[model samples]
Target: MPILRNTKKEAVIKDITVIGGGVVGASTALHLASLGYQITIVDQNNSNIAKNSEHRTGSTASLGVLMGNIFTRHKGRSWELRKRSMEIWPELIKSLSTEELPIIVNTPLVKIASSKEEMIKMENLIKQKKYLGIDFLPDNYQSLPIWIKNKYGGLISYNDGQINSLKLIDSLFLKLKSLNVNIITSKVKYIKRINDNTRIWSVILEDGKAINSHIVIICAAAESERLLQQLNYKLPLTKILGQAIKLKFKNSQVNFSGWPAIVNIKGINLIPEQPDSLLIGATLENELSPDKKYLHQMLETIREKAEWMQNYLIKEKWYGHRAKPINEPAPILKSIEKGLIINTAHYRNGVLLSPACAEWVSLEINKFHQ
Candidate 1:
């Protein structure tokens, strides 16, 4: 009888609250709302859903590089998660068709080996591509761009796609609004469980307002650990700060829109954002925030390493933080207690992994009913 009561509570569960309005949180809200669950999304900044600023969130600052099979080093859980996420991209795009946002860029991905050892590894990965839909570009591959200095070798994966991260988040928000989902702008001060075993949680905001829900999912990225710590659940999540730069070619004749994203083994990448503008990024730093001096040096290093970028003009430079679980390569999805779900720590693959994580978390929550 007691178990039936819990199961009844689960089956009848209606109100769901999602903390953090990032891509993962937004996608979760969209899916849960579509499933007919009442959802309220709480975020510290409501502007994130409307316009992801370069200074605000990492998702917007990203070049939206969907590596797909090109990121062959990931295996086990990480690889599976990415593959599943890729599979859902088309469906997710169809759902956003009415929004008219830039849903996806069907572009290829090219990865260059940084060294001879890296080249060997690439060769092996290509030979062992299995069903990953990748192609090996031998050293003599003539289609290589003149600007690209691939001394080792290159591998191309044709199925990779990209999206404007900011627009994607905004589209999610629009989808949520169309579904009549409630959007609350506030910082969650603390989450209070109704009791040790009840299927309800109360999210207390910084403004002293509280919202009780049948379930609460935390997709707060870098802030997830602190919120979990407040609930006495310790998760080892590190905040890695990254900086990226946007450059436009000084000469109008240069066009990069059709170019596949060029990435090296060391993780330095150049992705085209538009015809004349290319987005080059990203130095992973141990610090939690960006230091002006260090960021300048990091950008300089990126410029020097990619000597071909010398012809481009700097448009803007920005930085954002991604969350990584200590010593863990994959994002985490776990239910600590009844109706409490943690969905965070996506690291560099947030855009690539959000869809699958959202789907996984939704299914995990639904399991309570079953």
Candidate 2:
């Protein structure tokens, strides 16, 4: 473990390297850059993974649903992370919006209850969260959208919303560049301690390049396990496959105005990408490739509720791998060693939890200097 020290006259400025360029990594870089650290982000730039049908990263494949206030869990680590992120999201979005970045769609999230049992659960949740601006609607509610067919009631969380993950990352990078943070397009081969005494890290790239940093935070999702193995440190992480599809409405006059950006039916999410297009998806599987059967089954579930969905044509389909921790709670946000931190393995909640996790990484780095 490296020992970091600061002089009394002035605080030492440290070089920090983040090993992923996804939402989590980009958010971390932006947060650290705000703290006036020398930041460098390295990513392999696998942007074309969708066209190539390769292993897609979680950030790009996500539907970007932010269900913080709507989450069932009200207490525990998960809730804490979600709460913190929710608190930061508004300010973050406002700051970004000041720069004219359209990263988030500020709309409420509607979670429909498909079964009577689910309806009862939602009813109880509505009572419990009455102070949180959550609204419950019965099946006969007058304002329910005509497109959705529901026998059971639903809950609407006004504070929860959806994000445009791709735009969020792009906006963060733009902010990083404005802050003079260095962005590198490369793959890190491994990281090793420069010396036992100084605690500096030598981040070696595949191209025979080595960049030294005072701190290294691994936000590489499932790839973090392989990187840690190089240092003989083990963190059990597995990749969970999630698939989603985009659909375009055939009817040009279809009216979807004033609709919430996200509508979660059962375990599936329906997102509005545009007025005439919808994004539905996300099946969690333990395989490397997408399961067509599962994807269709999810679509079928949605189709059963909304017959109008039959008029929509599939525009695109994509899948990505999310990192899940085996036998551990998700979102391993902590410093394993003095100068080494791991903030990956967020699984499906990467988009929702990245901001809080990034703040965690920055605090850990600050602790070292203290």
Best by TM-score: 2
| Model 2 Cα lDDT, one tens digit per residue, 1-370 | 0111211223474688999988899888888877778899888884333443434678888888888877777899899888888878887876665346666556788888888999888888888777777888533433645467767778888888988876776677778889898888889999999997888888998898988988898999999999999999898999999998888898866556657778888879888778888888789899988888888888888879886776778788888999999979998887878788999999989999988888878767667643
lDDT for each candidate structure: 0.75, 0.81
What does candidate 1's lDDT look like per residue over 1-370, in tens digits?
Answer: 0011012223577889999888889988887777778999998887463232456576766667777676556567778778788888777877775635657655667777668988788777877774677777645434534346666767877677667777787788888999999999889988888766665689999989999987999999888888889889899988888887778888766666446655443576777777788777677888967777765675565555455555778787788888889966658888887788988888888888887787787678767532
Report the Cα lDDT for candidate 2: 0.81
**Candidate no. 2 TM-score:** 0.92
User: Which stretches of model 1 miss by more than 4 angstroms?
Assistant: 1-10, 48-54, 73-75, 138-145, 261-265, 292-307
